[model samples]
Target: MTNALVIGASGGIGTALAAALEGQGRAVTRLSRADGLDLRDPDATGRALDALDGPFERILLATGILAPSGRSPEKSLARIDAAAMAEVLAVNTIGTALVLRALPRLLARDGAGKVGVLTARVGSIGDNRLGGWHAYRASKAAANMLIRGAAIELARSHKGVTCVALHPGTVATDFTAGYPAHAKHGPEQAARALLDVLDGLGPDESGGFFDYAGRPVPW
Candidate 1:
């Protein structure tokens, strides 16, 4: 039986992704703060995964933050706040690294296993024409580096492992509620698209960053 894992299961994209996988006949394991897997707390994260049995063929780390609550994305370098930036990095990058620390046990070794770390297109260094959201951008960019490094390390040991950073675009969620975007996808639509993208990736593309459309994003 195919099993899947979604770390931020309570969030919009995470919920949709988990449901979509279940609809595809996978037994989905959902973990969130309700499950005591708080990314902000390293001990909680370790304890939560320790309780799970895995080698899940699909694993999605869907947790991310645009900024800390009561704060909007920074409009200029002057707007960068130390505490808010730290919080963003805590959830998006460092926390993600901590999660990948369990990769050797959580992902399948004998067959194809895929891990998608949700990031953003704005995180791209080469694609940056308009600049703002300093902390969010830096956090995701750092997260992508972690994904690349993880993918490379896993490739030397784990067969058929494809771990990559994914850009879900802008989805209609509280995460994007106040953020005005010219284009936004519904959670379900984004889930299906992201799944499709993941399905098409292979070991050769493991460390690359890609959009929901499966096009490689410039790092």
Candidate 2:
């Protein structure tokens, strides 16, 4: 049976994605902070990944943080708090980096394996119009860069691995509970759409960013 792994399996999008993958009859393995896979802790993250037996056909990381708890994303340069920014970057960018280090071996080296790194259009430097949420935006942008770089290197070593960034759109989750107006999609719908997007990608499309509609997001 084909196997898949989701790194942020406890989060809103992560749970839905796992269920969807299972519905497709794929053997799914899950890891998250709730299951002792804290991406923020490198050693813990490394240990969790080390336990996994891989050659997975698909690997997705739904990990991210919009901002620290009890605080909103900064709307202006004057409002950017150093500590809050650090926390955002820690979860959204740096933690993912640690997880990424193990991915080269976890995925199929010969068969065409697909990787989806959850990111956002807000992370797109070319799509930025409002220019707020400095830290969250910057962290995601960096994550995109990381994925792009990974795609380039993986194409060389793991020729069949297609790695790219994904934007799930405005899903109604705890993360967006505050902005009720933008809560247009349920997590399940978003997950299915993202999976479809992943299904359509090829090596030529790797290192690109795409939205749930399977359209490329300007980088």
Candidate 3:
């Protein structure tokens, strides 16, 4: 049986992805802040993940926050807040790095092992036509770099391991509740789309960023 681990299993997309994986007959291990696996605490995150023995074929780090509590994505440079930006980075960038750093030993060493870190199109510097959401955008951009760097290093030792960043597009989850005007996919739809992209990925495409539709997103 295929084994998978989902780090942010409580959120809408995360929950849907976990369920979808299970539905496909993959045994999935889920961890989340609700389960006391707070990504903000690296030691705790390490311990929690260490408890699991792997050879997991797939690991998805689907945790991210658009804004800190009592805050929103900045609409202008004047709206930027250092504290809020820090919070955004804590969850989106730093949290992702922590989870990714734990991967080498957890993934299948002899065969295909896929790791997908959920990022956003806004994170793409070359694709950012409209400017706004400074913190969230910047944090995800940092995450993309980290994913790429980690993928390169992992390939040197684990040739079968593939790590890539994924953009889920606009999803109709509470995460996007603040911007209802944008078209969004339901969590289930987004989950399926993302999994399809992951399923299609070959080692040759590792370390790249792609959208739900499997199109490469410019950095």
Candidate 4:
């Protein structure tokens, strides 16, 4: 059976992905801040990941935040809040970095393991059309760069481990509750799509960014 780890498992897409993995008869380990695996706390995050036994077939870092309390995405440069941007990067970019730093040992060194960092299409500098979410977008862009760099290093150090950033589309979760007019997929659907995309990826596709449909997203 495939062994899988789902970080941020308390969130909508994360919860659905965990369920889907379990439903497929895979052994699943779920981690979340609610369960004390807070990624924002590096010490806690490191300890939790360090305790996990090896060679998971798949690992998903599904944590991200649009904005912090009392703040919203900047519509213009004038609306940028330094504190809020820092908070977004803490949870979205730096938090994922902590997990990425711990992933090499937890993955199958035999070149059979895959790791995915959830990112956003809006993070794509070449694909940005209606740019408004400055902080969130910037955090995701940085996270994508981190994933790409990690993938390159892991390829040399861990052989066949494929690390890529994924976009789950506009998921019908609290994450998208602010934009009711946008097209969205239910968490279950989005989770399944992401898994299917993962199923099709190989080491050759490492360090790339792709959307829920497995289509490449411009970086």
Q: For residues 14-119, could you state the per-residue lDDT of candidate 3 as single tens digits?
A: 9999999998899999998866787778788888888877979989888988898778899999999988899899888988888888889898667899998999
TM-score of each: 0.98, 0.98, 0.97, 0.97
Query: For all candidates, what are the clash counts?
Result: 0, 0, 0, 1
Error of 4 at 129 (Å): 2.0
lDDT of 2 by residue, 5-122 (tens): 9988988999999999999999999998867787678788888889999989989999888889899999999999999999999899998798788888898778899999999999
For model 4, how does the per-residue alpha-carbon lDDT over 1-219 read when each residue is reduced to its tens digit?
A: 889999999999999999988988999999887667876688888888887886799898898888996566899988988999899999999998999998878887775898988999999999998978999999999999999999999999887888999999999998788888998889999999999998899999999999999999999
Model 3 RMSD, rounded to 1 decimal: 0.9
lDDT per residue as tens, model 1, 55-90: 799999999888998889999999999999999999
Q: Tally clashes: model 1.
A: 0
Native-vs-model 2 lDDT? 0.91
Please report, in order, the local distance difference test score of every candidate based on alpha carbons: 0.92, 0.91, 0.91, 0.89
| Candidate 1 similarity to native, TM-score | 0.98
The candidate that achieves the highest lDDT relative to the unseen native structure: 1
As a TM-score, model 2 comes out at: 0.98
Query: Which consecutive 10 residues in model 2 have the weakest lDDT in total?
Result: 33-42
Model 1 ranges off by over 4 Å: none
Clashes of 4: 1
